[model samples]
Target: MAEKKEQPDASKDEPEQIVDPWRVVTTSEKGVDYDKLIRQFGSERIDDAMLKRFEEVTGHKPHRFLRRGIFFSHRELKNILDLYEAKKPFFLYTGRGPSSSSMHVGHLIPFIFTKWLQDVFDVPLVVQMTDDEKFLWRELETPDVARNLAYENAKDIISCGFHRDKTFIFSNIDYISSCAAFYKNMLKVEKLVTFNQVRGIFGFNESDAIGKISFPAIQATPSFSNSFPEIFGEAADVPCLIPCAIDQDPYFRMTRDVAPKLNYLKPALIHSTFFPALQGAQTKMSASDKTSSIFLTDTQEEIKNKINRYAYSGGGSTEAEHREKGGDCDVDISYQYLTFFLEDDDRLAKIKEEYSSGRMMTGELKRELVVVLQSLIGDIQEKRRAVTDDIRRHFMTPRKLNHKA
Candidate 1:
């Protein structure tokens, strides 16, 4: 019999047991069935027919390839599409609570999809970096850490090709200082929203600070374009829409409930499902947990090493077993991640077929993912490198935005 051929260890730096995918499987788990998750996430699946219908209905080719299931879940998206078709103006609002120096790959999903939406609709995009929220949560030195982190996060976002003329990026700490109009709107939101409502909406205990109760208002302020009157001017007549994950719905839900009473446009919403961490969907990724995600700053060599070492696989023991039995690609972390990055529709379909039917080995699947992701992240890192302090300051400066409107 031929000697059992051992593959070269892609994991050259680590110890033997650390690279095991089964390490994540402490007890045997019948992993997350994604089809069931689609229903649970409250977004309709976009099949090929739906994609064709979406284009016919909108009269524009989608800015994104909906084929890969990136924008998987949506609520009230078609209604908003109708509004866009009518040439009605609606601003895009989405935010991130800056808690760390660098965000993980999980962090980029919304921004990537949001960039596509901006290109598709040609609408204004307002990105809020919630430094205040981070200050309240972490034991940071007052607001400095949050501010610094927000600046870092903003650079990563600016790398996403957002049009500076149409996009306004704000850090709560910095923007709050000069934009008294923004705060005036925030105060209105604060008064209308009750402590009980916040407790119910955010799961805030009574022990939380007055600041904690107030932060939601800061988030809500952007939903109204007039908060930045310099940008929106008296055109408070223009309604707004927010595109963020469903976990954030409560803030907007509270806003929607209060907008009518306040006589503001009850901000329209488009909610997406939570981006699953590399480990799984049950919990969001933590920057504190280094192993839970692949970050943009990771090196090409590091990307390959990490996937080989940490990315979960669904292939069998022997190549013979893989060819005969086929691999289970449904829950494999590597294949699922590839769906997000790989752009070629036909190549992805073929890969899916081969992997699902066990024709392609897990190593092969991971190898393909590694190359594509390496290029994507490498390109991002290059753009990020070119973003100098001068460029960032221009983007971060509140006054630079065309507030004359």
Candidate 2:
């Protein structure tokens, strides 16, 4: 008989994971391999040594997100820490693109962590509302509609408890006109970067609009301190530490590349993992899809219903089978959400142990998550209701922030 030939395993040929500013997709039930992403994106992993150094430098325990590895990657973070140790000046920069009138709970991750950072470091913070980016990307009615969404979203952001004196939040449409220095830096970045450069960096093609091609420069301008001369006082060398999700890295990657050419300091970044959709870890939550996320505006009843009906369960199909095999917390959406919101470490650990051992049924695990989300969203709704037009204006205004930098 002839020698038998072995066929290759077809499962190994699964589609590549996709992660960018617009989308996140993965085939694995366990979610995107962040270690692969760190290697692909050329950013350093946040290890325990760095965390220890961070605590030593700041004299404060790291945020839950940091300790739990939710905020897992970084670029040039050590430089920012060194600046802080030397009593030198540095600020924070992070932003949001308003695609809808209301933000989902997933949208709160960066802001909640950034608020903690601002409190600990006592530094100035700048938040950009990218209304123009949304207008160009989404099928919105008009630029005015996008601008209105920005204002609505800003109210939610302000409710996160950022200090008005230390934080400056501005919409691109309004701020570009009011601030001359911001526009100047945008122009500087645009002049240096060619069509091919952005096309390669952002996956832009010939069919895309010129506005889309040029918008990266607007996002990049904030990395430089001189762009906010009123706040940083013409010192282009003053650095900034940006706390944002990993998907936002492409813009800052281009910003860092252009910094040396412009003689500006490169901004440091701390990247958080994506907030997975309710369905599963296969993708991120989308503002346009109501079923994919639990929005800030969702009622307590709605939250409970969503958790029961839609949140993906990693339990066995039958109660007897689940009890025999135990549940898998790795792919369970309810357990994943608790990791992000539930601050009590011991409680979370106990829940994990019980759920994984099949001692706690899926219903019980989800009920715990539902309670956490209900309380969190309820508190946010109350705070947002208190943010009047005047309060929003104060945060949006272009004024000197209260920071040594």
Candidate 3:
């Protein structure tokens, strides 16, 4: 009798372990389960009914990000919409942790959508440059590194065409000394949040510095209107709407829990999905990892080369196999990038169908993405060049905003 064929071990072929959603998990070869994340995080889904209500109240079509489920989760978003419908005053609050001097394309997602929200709602926007947090969290040598990076990042944010008259950008290091109320609120929040609470929320260990343990209070202080008396008058009860990635929800969750005790309005939130690394959605795009992201400063050649070399493809191993099996757009990095940057819905749908049906090759799909990104990044670079020191100062100044609705 012929010898029995040896069986292969199935466990060896299993996918890589998924990255933890809580941490900024950098490029996992296998992608994350967003559904599992939603359940674990305990955030509500952005469903059809919510979308309809959003459009009805805003009196404008929901942004493509909202319609596409890119901004998929929220906490008390309807409350903000309800306040908007009632003509009650509320302000936009979103932030950047300035760990690097240059921002990548992934950094633009929140600012772009926040700009749209400001335009539609016609409200004042306060952008916090978390230099203090970055200094504590990142392996920076001095406060100056964080401060300088904050200014550079501010320029990138200003380049997104935010209204200087209605937008206020501030670095925590610079602004903390100027605002007494900010520190007061920070103290209040710190008092309310326990050591155990922060450790549980952030996974902080005993070895971590005291600054790291207390930094959440500083970030949380901005949620209260009292922290920014320059824009919203002293002791103003103005509510805030925070647009940030889902990973940041934990910070705001702690803030929300403490809000009622402080007699402050719980800041409403709209959370976006992470912009995937060039390799895949399994990891977040890292600013330090040159191979992982397309930076705003990247040359067109770099963008083209990176997309070709690193972007994970869903196409089959062989051309004939690809034609027979078709590409999976869900896992295709190029196709995913197009969904975010490509504004034309009909065109995107057509491309998706063609690519899915094996009519369009992976090269063609990536070529389309390269063009879209090049144009987008080029426009930003041109606008950023026009952002002089005076212009940057204009945006960063803490003067009263012309917040007329």
Highest TM-score: which candidate? 2
lDDT of 3 by residue, 205-305 (tens): 99999998999898888899889888877854898999998888788878888898888988988999889999888778888899998999999999999
- Answer with 1 or 3, whichever has the higher lDDT: 3
Model 2 gets an lDDT of 0.91
For model 2, residues 102-145, the per-residue Cα lDDT tens digits are: 99989999999999999998999999999999999999989999
Query: Can you list the residue pairs that collide in candidate 2?
Result: none
The lowest-lDDT stretch of 10 consecutive residues in candidate 3 is: 1-10
State every prediction's TM-score relative to the real structure.
0.85, 0.96, 0.93
Write down the TM-score for model 2: 0.96
- Cα displacement (angstroms), candidate 1, residue 36, comes to 8.1
Question: What is the Cα root-mean-square deviation between model 3 and the actual structure?
Answer: 7.9
Off by more than 4 A, model 1: 1-54, 63-65, 317-320, 399-405
Pairs clashing within candidate 1: 230-403, 231-403, 326-358, 327-358
Instruction: Provide the global lDDT of candidate 3 against the true structure.
Output: 0.87
Q: After superposition, how far is residue 125 of candidate 1 from its true place, in Å?
A: 1.1
Best by lDDT: 2
Question: What are the RMSD figures for all models against the true structure?
Answer: 10.7, 6.2, 7.9
* Candidate 1 to truth, TM: 0.85
- How many backbone clashes does every candidate have? 4, 0, 1
Residues 1-405 of candidate 1 have per-residue lDDT tens digits of: 111113324344522221110111211223333344343333345567656766876677754435555554454556666777676767788888787888777778788878887877777788999999889877889798789999998999988888877788889999888888888888898888888878855767878887887888888889887787656775666677677655575566677767777778777665454444566544556777777788877888888888888776677778888888887766577877876777777887899899978878888898998998888888889989888878787777664353222
